[model samples]
Target: MAALSGLAVTGGTIAACTGKAKPQVQGKLLGPSFKAGHLLRKGINVVPTETEEQEVVIVGGGASGLAAARWLKKHSDKNILLLELENETGGNSAAGKNEQTAYPWGAHYLPLPNNSFTELLDFLQETNVITGYDAKGLPIYNEYYLCFDPEERLYINNYWQEGLVPRWGVPENDLQQIERFQQLTEELKQAKGIDGKYAFDIPVDHSSADAQYRDLDQLTMLEWLQQHELTSEYLHWYVDYACRDDFGSALAHTSAWAGIHYFASRKAEASNSEPHRILTWPEGNNWLVQRLRESCTDRIRTNAMVYRVGEQDGKVAVDYMDLRTQKYKRILAEQCIMATPQFVNQRLLSALPELLSTRNLQSFEYVPWLVANLTLKDVPHGKGLSLCWDNVIYGSKSLGYVYANHQQVALFPEKKTITFYHALADEAPAAARGKAYGSSYEDWKAVVLQELEKAHPGIQEQVEQLDVWVWGHGMIYPKPGFIWSEDRQQAGAPYQNKLYFAHTDLSGISVFEEAFYRGITAARQLLNTERA
Candidate 1:
C-alpha cells in the first residue's frame, strides 16, 4: 500500500513564539502532525471507516454512467453508488480549457433531436436548452447555443466549399443517386412493422423486430448499397463518411440495418428550431455531463478501479482498488449495472463464479480515435465560406475539425484556438491502440500538425500548443453481420437477474443519442425489477 502523506486540519495553522519572534499558525487543527509517519486524510474520509454498501452499484462514470446515476436517483428511494475508474465522471465526454477556449477531448457535437425523443428534450428543457414550449406546444431551443451559421465546409480540389455532401463538381449521375438515396431514406422514416413499431427508432430496442428489417442487420452496408444500384463514387464516399463519423467504421464494415437506421431514425421537428439544427456547447457533450453529475455527486467514488464482481451471500460483491490509496476494497450490493463497454465487461464478468460464455461478446469490434486540440494565434482563411460547425476536406481520411470558439459569439480580436479532430478509421483498433500507446507526445503532435498543414499552409507557425488524446476503444463498430447477429442481442441482455448491460454498443450504432437512450433503458429496466 502507498503511504499517506498529509495532515488534516479543521481550520488553519497556529503561531509559535521564540525570543519575541512570532510564527503564526491559523485555523483549528483536527488530526496528527505531518513530518513523515503521518497518514493523509482528506474530505469525509478523515475518520477511518469500514467498507460501505448500497442497493445499486453503477460502474463507469462516463456519459452513460452519469446518465444511469441520474435516472436511478430520480426514480428510486433506495441507496445508490456510482463507481468511476477515472478521477472525473464524464468519461469520454470529458473536456478541457486552455487560456483561450474550452475544447472537447472526444465527442464534440450532437445533431438535432427528433420530436419523438421526449425524454432527451425534457432534459434539455431542464438545462434551459429548451426555454419553453410555444403556444402550440413546440419546444423553443436556445438561440445562443444552436450551432452557428456556416454549419459545414468541405475542401476539395484546393477549393473550400459549403456543406458535407459532395456537391461542388459532383457528376450528374452521382447527384441523381444521392437524391434517390435520400428518397429511399424518407420512405424508411415512415416504415412500420405489423406490430406498429417504426422500422427504425431512437432507442433502437423500440424498433420493429420484423424479420424483414431485422434481416437487413445480417448484411453489410456496402452490400445493401450495391444491391440498390447506388454505385456513384460520390454517393459512396458520402455514405462512407457518415458511417465513419457516427459508427466509427466504414460502410464495408457497418451493418445495413445500422446504416439505413442512421438516416431513417431521425423524425424530429420543432416550432422554433429547424429539424436539422443541433444543440451544442464549446465543451461538447461535457455540458450534458455536468447536469447529470448534479444529482449523483454525493454517491459517486472516482478513481476506483473495479477488478472483480461476483455473487457473495446472495448479494453482488464488487472488488475494486483505490488508485490513490493503492488498497483493494470490496462492496456488496443487491444489483449491479455494468455500464462499461463490452470489452471491459468481459474481463470483469470473467471473474464471476458462474461466468457466461464470452463467445458472443468477442465478436464486437471497437475502433480507436485520435483527437488533437490545437491552440493557435489565428486560423488561415480559405477560399469559400469561413470556419463552420463541422469542417472537412473531401477525400481526406480525417474528419477535419470544429472551431472550438465558434459557439462563443463574443469574439476576441486575436489569439484564437481551434481543435483539429482526426479519426483514424482506416486502421484496426488493436493496431491503432498499440501504435497510439507507443507514440511519444512529439510523434502524435507531428501527426496532427502534418494533417493540419494540408488545409492551412504555415499553420505550424500559428500554433502555440498541440495536445493529443487517443481513445483505444472509442466505439463499437456495426461490423457487417455483427449488428443483426444473435450474439449481439444475447450479449446485451441481462444475465441471471444480477447483472445488467448498457452502452452505445448495444444499439449497434455508437452515437450520443444511442448512448443516452441505452443508459435510460438499463435504468428503467432496473427500476422495473425493483418495483416488481
Candidate 2:
C-alpha cells in the first residue's frame, strides 16, 4: 500500500451515526483461494506428469515476480517463464471491475518517485505516468493520472475538513504542535548521514548504514515520538494512522527508523504537480501492474501453483501444478528467482532446508487486511467539503474508503464504486488474522457498514453491492530492529548462484518501489552471475 506523509492536528469531541442496522446488501464474500496455499500446510505429495525446461524460472507472480520477469526480458534473452497462482499476475495490486467502474482490492496509489530513483522514473515514463521532464529537469506528470482535485478530506468533530492534516477549529496550541511536527519532518527530509547518503532511502536498502540513523531501528515509533516530547493527542493519532496506513503496524509496533522513513524518504518533485501528490487510477495500482505486464504477457502462465523449488544437479528445479489442467509439472532452469514472500518460501524451499535459517525467516512478520468495494446507488452525502478521492473517518478503526471513480469527468453519476481498506493493526497479528480469515460475510458486512455509517449516516441503503477481500498475509511489517537487521540482509541473499530472492518483505516494508527494486536486484544478480 502507498503511504501518504505524516499529518498532525487538534483533538475534538464527535458524535456517531446511530441509524443503520446492517442493511442486507447484495454481493459475494471474495478472497484468495486459501485452499491453494493451505495445501502446503500438510505435505502435498505429487509426481511430475510432465517435464519442462527454461533458461530462467520466476516463481510467484506478485509485483516482485512480474518486475523480475520484466527486467530479465529487458536485460537478457534467456527463455523465461513467470508462474502466477491466481488467474492474474498482480498480487496485492490486483483489481476488479463491475458494471459501474473499476476498483482495487488492495494497494491503490503510487506516490511520485524520488528523482534519484532513475529506474522507477524510467518505468513511469515508459507507462506515460511521467509524460516528460521540464527544462528545470523536474518531471511533468500526466494530468490524467495525477490524483484529481479535492484529493482528500477527513471527517472530524462531526464535520468534514478539506485536508487530512486536521487544522480547522484547532486550538492555537494544537496548531503550534502540528507546525512543529511539520518542521521536523522537513528537516529530516533533507538530513543525510555522515556516510554521504540520505538517512532514509525509498528502496530502503540504499539508505546509509551510518549508526546515527540505524540506531533508531532499535526503538519503536511511539518511543521516538515520546523521546522528542511531541505528544499531542492529535499528533499521536495522526502518526499512528500513518503507521497503520503504510506499515500495517501500530506506532508502538513499528520501528522508529521505518516510521521516520515514511515521512523523510520521499523527495519527489514534479513539474505539473506538488511533490506530495500521488498518481492513481480507477483500478488503482492495477493500471501500473498492467503496464508492467504488457511486454512479458506472453511469457506469463496464470493458475500455476508452484509448490517446491530447489537445486538439482547443476540447475534449479521447480515443481508446480497447473490449476487449469490439474496436472503437475517439473521445470529445470539454469537460474531461478523466488519472487515469493518468505512466508511462502518457508515451505517452497523446505526441500533445501539449509538455504534458510529458522531465525532469519522468523524475523519477517506480515499483517492481515480487509478490503471491501461497495457500489453505491448514488453519490454519498456527507457534511462539509465535497466528496474527494480519499475520505477518512476520524477515530474509526478502518482506514476509510476511496472513491474509485473520483477521476471520472462525469459528475454525480447514478452509480459509483468506492473501495474501503481496514488494516488489522489494532490487536495481535494472530488474533487479527484469525478473525479476518474466520469471520463470515455477515460479520464483515456489519463491520464495513458500521465504519461507513460514521460518515454517511443511514446511507447503507444506498449500497448496491459490498464485496469483501481478505489479505491474510497482506504485506510485511517493519518491526523494531528488523529493517536494518542482518537477518533481513541474509534472507534476501542469492543461494548457490542458482536461486535469487525478491520481495518487499525482504526489505522489512512492503511498497511498490521496494518490490520493484528487489525484483530488479534479483534479476541483476542472475545476469551478473551469468556474465561471471
What is the clash tally of candidate 2?
A: 0
lDDT of 1 by residue, 132-174 (tens): 8888888888888788887888887677788888888888988
Which of the numbered candidates is closest to the native, going by highest TM-score?
Answer: 2
Candidate 2: which stretches are off by over 4 Å? 1-23
lDDT of 2 by residue, 111-220 (tens): 99899999999999998888999999999999999999999999998888988886767778877887888898888889889989998888897898889899999999
Off by more than 4 A, model 1:
1-50
* lDDT (C-alpha) at residue 371 in model 2: 92
lDDT of each: 0.74, 0.85
lDDT of 1 at 39: 23
lDDT of 2: 0.85
Q: After superposition, how far is residue 486 of candidate 1 from its true place, in Å?
A: 2.1
| Reference-based TM-score, model 2 | 0.95
Residue 479 alpha-carbon offset, candidate 2, angstroms: 1.0
